[model samples]
Target: MLHLRVIAPAELRNPILNVLQREPGVTHIVLHPNAAVEPAGDEITADIAREAANDVVERLKSLDVQNLGAITLEVLDTVLSSAAYHAEDAADGDAADAVVWDELVARTRDESQLNVTFLLFLCIACLLAAVGVLTDSPVTVVGAMVVGPEFGPLAALAVALVRRRMSLARRASAALLIGFPVAMAVTAGATLGFEALGWVELTSTRELHGVDFIFQVGPFSFVVALLAGAAGMLSLVSAKSAALVGVFISVTTVPAAGFAVVAATMGDWDIAAQSVAQLAVNLVGITIAGVLVLAVYRRLQTAKESGGRRSAGV
Candidate 1:
């Protein structure tokens, strides 16, 4: 369920009331006429069934409530009403499966910010992966994967592509194009700095078989990335954020890219080339999977809507 608070002008209060009155899933309606001092309008509040929220929100938006006044919606944790139950039954689709495109675009736009904190986290994550590769530590590599912020931009790109938002797509692309190079460069610099400080030594060598985890690229790597990409986007869109950590752990982008930079710096071109290939494979797999999964979900949703229309004799 969702609690919606709308502030609209007095002139349109009647139309707004009509929308609420017409929606069977909307209840606990409260009207405060000319109650807003700053906005100088009526304040209306209602509890809308979660399943029916999308339709109700769309109707309200069609009236330009967002632009003229304001519309605030928040999730309702608890609703104890038979009316709410019937309202849920009255809804055309399940809210849990709902994809609010506007909400998604806003979320991705925010996540695509290429700020100093983003770079800082990226560098730290890359450095951790570099160290993990050098020491052949899967745990360290996993830690780097957890810290890396690259998934946000990747997911943003996927969302933009699905929504046909070119500006958002460019923002996500810039983040990735600028982020990876910067992070990889810092990883190399960190290696040099560590060597200078007598922290560890790395030399061009052929005995890097132990770190095969970083350099080994195969079809399975792509398959895992594809699954992780779908899971990551689903977790984000469905508000199941806890599942995101698992997605992070499942992808190889950070570790492979980090290893590529460090290996190249140490003159290990064979290992560097392999790591780069692994990185490329994982990134492409994730992207293609994300877009396809989102598209499929949308198609299924459309089919469900069509079925509902038929059921309603529409």
Candidate 2:
């Protein structure tokens, strides 16, 4: 179940209340008239079934409630009401299957931005992966994967394409373009510094071949990328952070970028080229897969809403 807190304009308060009252699986409606000091309106609260949440939010958005007021949603850990039980049972679909695009849009918008924290994590992840490659440590590579922030912009790109938001697409692209190259450049300098300090011994890369295969372009690479991308999109929309971490571990973008950086700085052009190709394959593969997954999910949502509207008419 989800709980909503709405602060609505004075004129829209009654209409908003009516909308909540009329919606199924929405219960425990409360209103405090003339309570909003800043907005000078009313404060309202409602409990909505998780399955009905997307619809309720959409309805409120259509009424322009978000434009004139604020709507906040919180997951309910415990609901004591018998009405809540029946409402949960009465919901039409599984809660986990709901996409809630508006919520997704808000989330990705914040994540896709080119911010200081984003660049910091990207650069750090790159350096860590570079260390992993130089030392041939799979553990270090996995740690770097978990640290990399590239997935946000990647997922943002997918969401932008699905939503056809050119501005967001450009922003996400800009983040990737700026973030990846900058990260590689920084790691390259770090690699040169490590070489001068005699901290790393550049080897044949054969010892790490089992793990280094991730830094090669192949059918297996594309297949893993596709699976990771799809799972990533699901994890993002569902707010499943653990699943997202798993997605990070399964992709090769960060590792390939770092490997390419170290190899190029060390004048190993063949390995550098191969790793760069691997990076490209992973990025493009995952992006295309993410776009497809989001598109399909969005279409299913549209269909479900359409079906609901038709059922209402009938």
Candidate 3:
């Protein structure tokens, strides 16, 4: 449900009230006319009288109410109504609007300076994967998989494509293109140093065998990537964020890249090529799947909106 508070001139109050009253899911309506404000009339206080505020926002926007001094809408979930309302109030919409675009850009930034925590997390993931390869430990491999941060750009790319935001897509792609290669190169260099120090062994591990999981790519690899990509986008759009962590673990992007680095360090050209191929397969698969899922989801949402409008005879 949504709660809406509208501060408008007393003359426009009736029209706005009429519009709000007809909106579906609106449980209450309150009017505050010519509320107290500073000389600029930029600040005015209004009381919320609606139970479902989201519905009111949609309606008010549709009505195009003139002389609307200020409009504020709040969403309320039945199970967490108080928390939801408080969250909305805390955001203040002004701050939210100011930061949303910047946040999106930051999320899609290419070659931006990463914070210490993020850099540490990435290094830790790569190091864990390196250890997993050397020790032939699938558990460690899975742990590394869960730590990878590749999914953020992937999901952002999906959102950009679905929204037809080319700049966003380009930024996201650039981040992935740059971040992955850099990570792989760093891992490769680390592996070489480890070997020189006699601290790591690349051979004698069954997991590193050419046939065990060494880049034996097929149609299935593409299919897995595609499915994982779709699931990743779903996890992002849905309220269930914890599911996204699992999705990251399920995809083999980090593992494949880690394996490629190990293979390259060992001078195993065949295994290296195969691992590279597997990495390519997964990247392409996820990108395609993400785009398709976003397209389908948008279409469904549009259809629902159209149906509602027709039902409302608007």
Best by TM-score: 2
**Candidate 3 lDDT tens digits, 1-314:** 33455655555556676664554333334444455362112222222323223334455556554234656544334524564454445331222112122223344444222444445556667767777777777788789889987777776777677667787777667667777777777787888888889997666333554333636788888988888888876665443568777777766777778877787677777777777898788888888897897678556545655876797699
lDDT of 2 by residue, 203-266 (tens): 5554565467656778898899899999999998777889999999998899999998877776
* lDDT to native, each model: 0.85, 0.85, 0.62
- In model 2, the worst 10-residue window by lDDT is 202-211
Question: Judged by TM-score relative to the true structure, which candidate is superior, 2 or 3?
Answer: 2
lDDT digits (tens) for residues 1-314 of candidate 1: 78889999999898899998888778888999999876779999998876666667788899999888998888778889887777777766777777766667778898888999889999999999988877777889899999999888888899889989999989988988899999999898888898899877887535656556767888899999999999998887788989999999988899998889878988888888998899888888888888987898779777886887898799
Residue runs of model 1 more than 4 Å from their true location after superposition? 37-40
lDDT of model number 2? 0.85
Per-prediction TM-score to the true structure, in the order listed: 0.90, 0.93, 0.70
Count of backbone collisions within predicted model 1: 0
Candidate 1 vs candidate 3: the TM-score winner is: 1
TM-score of 1: 0.90
